[model samples]
Target: MNKISIGQSELMASQISLGIMRMNALSVEEAKTVIETAISEGIDHFDHADIYGKGASETIFGQAFKKLGISRDSVILQTKTGIVPGIMYDFSKEHIIQSVEESLTRLQTDYVDTLLLHRPDALIEPEEVAEAFDELEKSGKVRTFGVSNHNPLQIELLKKFVNQPLIINQLQLSLTHTPMIDAGLNVNRTEAGSVLHEGQLIDYSRINDMTIQPWSPFQSGNGKKGLFFDHPDYLELNKVVNEMAKEKGVAREAIAIAWLLRHPAKMQPIVGTMNPDRIKAITKTTEISLSREEWYKLYLSGGKMLP
Candidate 1:
């Protein structure tokens, strides 16, 4: 796997990270095998969220880690917090500290390599968040901080008060759901693609040296249903991906991920597949790089039009 430095942090994260959101569906033994398979394929970064499987996912992963007898420092564990399920989003100092404490207990680790606010809280107070971060950092509970599903101004709101660097911003991005890329390509045009829905997020991330972590890389973002593969609306995209897979001698998923890696932003895609075989197949993305012409072809195949 290729390693990219996360923003200005010292953590050199893997280009592709295994998301444990669906790990709750697997038994302890199965989860262990999946993790081992990813590690064997050079995937060292694991992504998690506090609300995933109601926290059972992290618990199962912790059990798997203990069963494997691996050292704590051998891998990077990143988790998100602040979502209270059906209740509300909480960024209060008390909730932030309590959430990480519970996550640490469930993960069988003393500290997380990184902690993120799962989503924005409309009623959030930035100073309260800053205080919570300060306490966590000083106590060695969380090594770094970040946010997920936050727009550029939302990040700036937190950065105004939080002392630690907000290094990563996780967003939903895929070939079909690509307003970030589309807005840039269609600048000054009257087309719908020219309207900025994400507020120059890609450019802001690149300019600020923050890493953009693409979640649900295979899923459509604009209220579309299910994975992009085999979707009726994405027949053209499937055709192009299949053709590239045939030409590259790799799985279709590898071509999909390679398209994200082709961008100069150096995005880290969080793949949530639990199948070990599929994980291994997708790991081959590091071996292939998409050329500019091929990248545009795949983009257009996804139903995007250039001005």
Candidate 2:
């Protein structure tokens, strides 16, 4: 596995991370197998969210991790907080502090390598967030801070008050879901692809030296439908991906992930597959490098047109 420095921090992690969102559905033994498989493939970073499986995922992961007997410092654990399910998004100092405390208890750890605000709270108060971060940092509960699904201005709003450098901004990016990349490529065009939905976050992250963590790397960009691997709308994309996989002697999943790694942004894709075989296959991404021509071919095949 290839290691990339997260943001400006000294923390170095695998270019691809395993997301434990669905770990709640697995028994302790099964979860252990999934985690062990990932670690064996050189994946040292694990991503989690407080809202995942209603905290059950974290509990299971904690149990499995303890059974493995691995040193805490050997792996990086990151979790997101602030979503209250059906209630509302909360960024209050009380919620932020309390959330991490609860997460620590469930994760079986005294501190997390990183903590992220799950999603942008419409009623976010920068001062409150800053206070929460200050207390967490001083107490050694969270080593680093970041945000997920936040736009450039939203990140700037938090940076205005939060003292810690927001080292990461996790976003959804895939070959089929290319709004961020499309906007940049279609600049000044009258086409729908010219609409800048994310405020050009790809450029913003690179300019600010913040790492962009791409989540849902294989999604079809359509809700609840499933991965793009065999999605009907993505037949062209599937063809290109399969051809590349055959040429490179890798699994189709690696070609999809390799497309993300081909970007200069150096995004760390969070792969959420729980299958041990899939985990092994996906890790093969590190061995293959997508050329510029091949990268564009895959992109164009994903129902995108270049001006």
- What is the per-residue lDDT of model 2 for residues 79-112, given as tens digits with 9 covering 90 to 100? 9999999999999999999999989999999999
Candidate 1 regions with alpha-carbon error over 4 angstroms: none
Q: Give, for candidate 2, the lowest lDDT window spanning 10 residues.
A: 218-227
TM accuracy, model 1: 0.99
Q: In lDDT terms, how accurate is model 1? A: 0.94
Q: What's the TM-score of each model vs. the native? A: 0.99, 0.99
